[model samples]
Target: MSAAAAATARDALRAATDAIHARLHGLPALQALAEGRIGRAGYVALLRRLLGFHAAVEAALADAPSLGPSLIPWGIDIAQRRRAGLIEADLATLGAALGASAGPVPLAPLPALGTVPRALGCLYVTEGSTLGGRQLARALDGLLPPGEAGRRFLLGHGARHGAMWRACCAALEHCGAEPARRAEMLAAAEATFLAFEAWFAGAP
Candidate 1:
């Protein structure tokens, strides 16, 4: 396909996934997190959930040859985006604040990804969340204690956030997922979104 056609295909995929994406964005639990209403532990719980889910996703990508390509950018390795480590540090801080141990974090429920399309779908939701995370991190900056400990996960990819998200989009564009793959991707994205919303809903 030509450039225009590729852009059209990407747009179509976005349109297919848009409704579920909007719903996830509008979830009450996510709103509370972004609105900075949740305390430090509540924020840590959110990161723990993300860490679990991402651990699953990244592990799959690392083991699956096809899926790994879907995440590898032009030059970076998958570890660069596997941001659970950042979350763990923040969890340690939050745990200390609560006078509790930080090492044993509860993992979020895993989303199924037996196929590359499904994996990409999950990646779409996860990477897209980072875009919104930049904003959420700022909101949290004021609410959390004066340090990077709490918002490190939100500030993931660091100064390269915009570039990393662009890379994610480029990866999607290159997938050249036909209509069927797009549908599978959309389903995966929807399920992933639902899982995250539910996780946050049940958080303390």
Candidate 2:
């Protein structure tokens, strides 16, 4: 990528990161608006907001040319999976955090959540890093013929994703909330992003 293009990509990434942080800060307030405890209605509203935010973040990623090809596909795949109910387990964990005793709530069943946009942006950001890292590792491995440095790079990149994913999981466990509940999910999402940021900064 051209230096200008790379700079633009970095800026876009930072903006997405900032946006995710902003949403994280806003979660408690949104949760309060949901009656201080998340229920079906509250969860629905939160999901809508998250979805909208995700869409915007995805758009920003689309504008970033520095991202590797794997990044885009990985992002699209995750979004599709979520839409296709693949995130049921994670969603259920979130539901439990929100005091939901029921199992995975279908996205189709939650109209309120569909009406707003929120966590989708952060989701995309995580996926972008994951995909980009994977692509970089693959390229390096191909070029270097499987040296320790290449292996280390791949491992580091994968670790970043793992840390972020774990952070998300931890956040869910922290709140005992449902997937559709924006406040808790956003907090968890923020944890995920921060973990990724830390990992990125520490990488060689």
Instruction: Evaluate all candidate structures by whole-model CA lDDT and list the values in order.
Output: 0.67, 0.36
Number of clashing pairs per prediction, in order: 0, 29
RMSD score of candidate 1 (Å): 4.4
How far is 179's C-alpha from truth in model 2 (Å)? 38
TM-scores for every candidate against the unseen true structure: 0.76, 0.27
- Candidate 2 residue 200 Cα shift, in angstroms, is 28
The total of clashing pairs for model 1 equals 0
Which candidate gets the maximum TM-score versus the true structure?
1
Point to the candidate with the largest lDDT. Answer: 1
**Model 1: residues >4 Å from true position, as ranges?**
1-10, 63-66, 69-76, 96-105, 145-147, 201-204
lDDT value for model 1? 0.67
Candidate 1 per-residue lDDT over residues 10-125, each given as its tens digit: 57556666666677766665677877786665666566667776766667667667655654543335667788777777777776432355555565665677676677667777
Q: Candidate 1: which pairs clash?
A: none
Model 2, 1-204: lDDT tens digits are 431232332333344356554543344424343233444444444434433333434444344444324333223233332221212222343342223564432221111111111233345344443444344335433234454332232233343456655443343233323334434334434545654334323322
